[model samples]
Target: MKSSNFLKYTALLVFAIAIGFFAYMVNASKALSYLSHDPKACINCHVMNTQYATWQHSSHARDVGCIDCHLPRDNMVNKYIAKARDGYNHSVAFTFNTYKNAIKISDDGAKRVQENCISCHASLTSQMVKNADANHNYDDPSVATGRRCWECHKGVPHGKVRGLTTTPNNLGVKEVQ
Candidate 1:
């Protein structure tokens, strides 16, 4: 009976310790920073230095934030859900040091960015659509088939900085060029 009781206590203690450690790690990493729309929250991870730096000089910097473009505008619940999912994924990736050096957006992220671009630049996209309709040609691949904004305007947020350098994994501060 005493041995069984001891084993039960040990299991409970281990579980509590694990929960405590996880909480500590999350707190130290500023995981809650993802909940806010601040662009600086993006640079909390050293890997984001290039993106953050590029965005500083981008035209969108004056108007929208990181979350504004990256997250969905469907509703608050959906937005928070996406944020939590991304935050969890980022935390796990950073914890395991498993993220790729050249960080690429997931398909879902790309969709969100495309949606944001269409919503934000409704006037411009409408004009493009009107032009495409007038110039519609079945043989022309260039004609608008509702191509994503990034498909043509790839240099909006990140600029032409792709393929510059592999993201550093050591968490050392490097100069963003």
Candidate 2:
């Protein structure tokens, strides 16, 4: 075959491969959209598996969707950066099979989470805390567990379980065909 014809063929093949890859990604994205909010879906990537499991059993899991807390409240730049950074971290942990996904986020993430929790629950108390009840010793580190939000309010409020029981269907229901 002529050298120019060979080069043309190679170029065409590469272009076809690129198009195929893009189409595959588009289809994959569609399927992923429905599952993205699921906590188990987050664990599919290995690195997040531990966190996902802990969260599933945790009070927060009942109410808080994965993106609800992980997503930043700030601008698109901040939100996407957090998402990308989280994705990169997940990929690294997944690749290494590191079970210790106990993320000690630079104190900043801790503060942000605390702040978000406090801000949302301002009406609940003078300040946010984990063990508002007298029996649950506030100081005993081992006895107490999970996000401070669960201390006064049961996991019901976060888990949507509470809403399911009390809320009327007409309140927020969107009728479908």
> What TM-score would each prediction reach against the true structure?
0.72, 0.54
95: Cα error in model 1, Å: 1.3
Residue-level error in angstroms, candidate 2, position 53: 2.7
lDDT per residue for candidate 1 within 1-177, as digits (tens), equals 999999999999999999999999879888777767888889788778778867776888888889999999989999989988988888788879998978989889989988888788887767765665623322357763655667667678877665435333343535433
- Clash number for candidate 2: 4
TM-score of candidate 2 to 2 decimals: 0.54
RMSD of 1: 4.9
- lDDT for each candidate structure: 0.77, 0.54
The candidate maximizing TM-score is: 1
Q: What stretches of model 1 exceed 4 Å from their correct place?
A: 1-23, 133-146, 162-177
